[model samples]
Target: MDLDQLRTFDRIVRDQSFTKAAAYLNITQATASMRIRALEQLLGVTLFVRGRTVTLTDQGMTFLPYARRIIGTAQEGREALRRVERGRVSIASLRTLVSPLITESLIRFQEHYPSVDVVVREGRQGQIAAMLHEREVEMGILCWPNIDPLVVDLEPLVIMRERVPLVVAADVAARLSSRPEIAEVLALVPRVIALRWWQADPETAAALVRLAKTSVELPTGPARRLAIKGEGLGFFVNSAIADDVKAGRLVEIAPVDFEPLHRDTAMVVRSLAALERPMLADFIREIALECAKMGEIIDDRLDKVVPRKPWPKPAIPHP
Candidate 1:
């Protein structure tokens, strides 16, 4: 079917006047009439009544829905193809993963491909993996469950552990004459509960269950806010709350190591031969280089920080 004629027919139906349809289409009235006539002939039916006013005949009335649907589908097809050409890379990640590491890589990626549009969809670690597996997204950052399918390749980029610590408000941290140990803090303090999407994994979930107390479990942003406001201490990933720590709004209670959770994020994609075009392959290689640089940065930071050794603190009277 000639989409141009279908468009002409639809416009005539909308305007209810061949002259007006021609004006709207910016074509000569004769051309518009000829296109409409061709469409009607192709369907072997009269589409319009040529009276004082234009009105759809029975055939046109029946064909309206089909025409509209065809036009809509064609528009969507065009959009999808445009996305592919413009380097629209689809990615999913846990909200926590959008910290300095990932964003830094993205910045470099954008500089490399300014025309490429990036679509980032946030979900839990598992959800991100599922999107990659189903090919709903081009790539994703996921923890746990390794990529197993022969068609997909997983390139290990970096392993980062979020430092979950017991924190106190600035005022509260000052009140303590000495550093409080984890068990002591847990016993005396009505600590804020730390909730994270990363805790969905079995190992992390079990660790959180061990730390459960009379606590309010909230999402990462709100939970961090609640802790900052002096509403009891909670467990939080260091990367997620770096700004707060630097600004002195929150204090890390010493010796309360909740064990840094180690997770590896990799770039997963269909094998090189399977890629439809060079654009996607180019993106994958770019991402791999970015990931390597990110891993180096993370390693440098970790190397500088001295590891904390377990130390006992004097007991404080229960308030």
Candidate 2:
């Protein structure tokens, strides 16, 4: 039976008088009687026996507990929604953006709202675009300068930029002085694994491809790994390589011809209206804060981060 009918039956049973129950519920006795009649007809069993004092039939006693549980569960669900104690959020992001920036943002968000669950899927622009179009996720992060969303419905939430560094493994760095000319560095370009995120710069891409002894394309994570292992030299965003440079796993070499390059990163959502949701909005704030912090770190190291000035190499004896 419906909630109204179930509630009427419960009120009558609790008060043990149809007349009194009607007054408590603010309904006429005729209305209460009509509700019980409808509930009994739906169940195909009488719920009560009418006499000088009304009492439950065997069927009413059996159904009471189930009705109470249904009401309690509905109330609990409403309370959980209000508290956001069990909320969930999902997003699609560029795998390249998942370093100390996005990953650190995830940690910050969890620290603040531990009860909220977050899911992140990494993909290229087309794949993330598809995910948003299918309603699989409400947000996506894109590496910029070549960024244009595939879906018209998507809207930008945040955009961050940082310098790009040309890094080689520590062992590779030992072969050259701290500030090598572009031609000197090119002589050692044995392998290059590049991310195609910069489709806007075809001339530069052609030059890199032609200069490298062996050039191949790979995802950011794998490319970073290969660069760390001395397998190749790569151009990477400072955020992705900052720790590597500090840890001596990789070295940033200032090459004379390579211009001071920077990469822009953007976060987008399915719509501006999505930010109206409290949980989504908070997530955006956490991520933006992390990105801003990353920008500050990048800015502080701007001279060394870009090839504009000589990068001070950690002392490593010449090979």
Candidate 3:
């Protein structure tokens, strides 16, 4: 019926004795009996057979799982609260958005506050937005600006943009002329398609995948893997394919107009959290410096893809 009652119920079943369960719960035996009775009355069925060795009735067996689930959820909530109280900062980032800049920022932050804990969750743009709204996380690193509508409650603390190079197989890379312009590459790969991951609108992505003559839209990792396998070409964040580029499996190329295809990503903070300027705020300068190092990437690809859609709307971040 309630968490306490369920806990008591579960304890009794596990311990196989009312007295033992009471002692485990640090309550009197009579109180444990009352709780079990109340639970049974509420359910209109007896849970355990009254005996030396306690046993569950048929209905009790069926109810155990549900009770355990509630207890587990309560325990998780308590743990999350404990972490937050202890000064742990939870941040969610799009999986592709793992740039070295963020990694460097984190390294600098840890050096200053080694005792503070940080939790990182990697997800899509929309999921990160939901986490920010729910207060499940205090900070979010995502592509584009998701806080426009929720502007009153959220603040765009840092915005980062970087050139995503077009990567191709070693053989394919050798054939293309050195430093081709955007129009030249498009002319060469007439079948290539574009993807906009900033807002992750299903309709926009669907159209890109639908209208494009070749090259299925892919997230960071798979796109790299496919390029390495000599399957196709893709635009990728530099950090994501550093190893492959160095190893000569993939070659990175830049077009004069490549910037138009990239998206902008931002680090957002809840306005209330900004006012508090919690531990994370201490590293703002470090993050900004890192962002500067990467340089700002503007001009959303959807505007390039849809042309009609507004610019600065949002990319696949990193691996």
Against the hidden true structure, what lDDT does model 1 obtain?
0.64
Better of 1 and 2 by TM-score: 1
Q: Rank the candidates by lDDT, best first.
A: 2, 3, 1
**lDDT per model, in order?**
0.64, 0.74, 0.68
Error of 3 at 224 (Å): 0.8
Q: List the candidate 2 regions with Cα displacement exceeding 4 Å.
A: 1-85, 145-149, 177-179, 199-202, 296-319
The numbered model that scores best in lDDT is 2
lDDT, residue 6, candidate 3: 98
lDDT of 2 by residue, 1-319 (tens): 7877878898988998899999998999999999999999999989898998899889989988987888778777887566545677888887767665567777766765666778788887778778888888877777543345557755555667767778888888899866787667767657876766553644655576677888878877788888988888777878778888999999887776766666676777767777655666666666777778766322222112222322233344469
> Whole-model lDDT for model 2 versus the true structure?
0.74
Local error of candidate 3 at residue 89 (angstroms) = 1.9
Best by TM-score: 3
RMSD of each: 13.1, 14.7, 9.7
**How many clashes show up per model?**
2, 0, 5
Model 3 residue 66 distance off true place after TM-score fit, in angstroms: 2.3
Extract clashing residue pairs from model 1.
Answer: 192-232, 192-233
